[model samples]
Target: MEVNQNDHSYNPGDIVYVFYRNPHTQDVANVQSAAVVNNPENPGELAIFLYETYYPLTNDMAVYQSEAEAMEVYEQYFSFE
Candidate 1:
């Protein structure tokens, strides 16, 4: 999908949080911070800069503006007590 400036709510340089699943520990997940940046591969598009990689911003991503927000959702579905 093509991304325009108006296509997403976040601006470049904005910090965003996301649930990151550990590669080796497939069952483990944690809330991690990522930076919103203009897609270097696709001009005018937005992507999440994390783990030294650029991931295109898509509708399926549950991106959060705050760590608390991310943790809240993470707990809702992933927490077991």
Candidate 2:
């Protein structure tokens, strides 16, 4: 599928949350990061790379299925209420 780069529907710098399970612990890791890239291959999807010390921990790369999924995970970790 071809990604429409001209589509202003979504921006690349938007903040979003993501929920992911750690392969080792089977624990859910919710993380938030800026939207890095969006294209046809990953349409309706967002990529969040693990940062150094403060963010999620990972050596390989990870991407969420959708924005809602990312937000849900982010809320799980950051939201108190």
Window of ten residues with lowest summed lDDT in model 2: 1-10
Evaluate model 1: give its lDDT: 0.85
Tens-place lDDT per residue, model 2, 1-81, is 122222323344544334555657775554545444443344555333434222322223333546776576577665768
Question: What TM-score would candidate 1 get against the native?
Answer: 0.87
**Clashing residue pairs in candidate 1 (N, C-alpha, C atoms within 3 angstroms):** none
Q: Each candidate: RMSD to true structure?
A: 3.3, 9.3
lDDT of 1 by residue, 1-81 (tens): 233332447878888899999999989999999999989998888899999999998878888878998899999989898
Ten-residue segment with the worst summed lDDT in candidate 1?
1-10
lDDT of 2 at 65: 41
Question: Distance from true position, residue 12, model 1, in Å?
Answer: 0.3
Estimate the TM-score of every prediction: 0.87, 0.32
Cα error, candidate 1, residue 4 (Å): 9.4
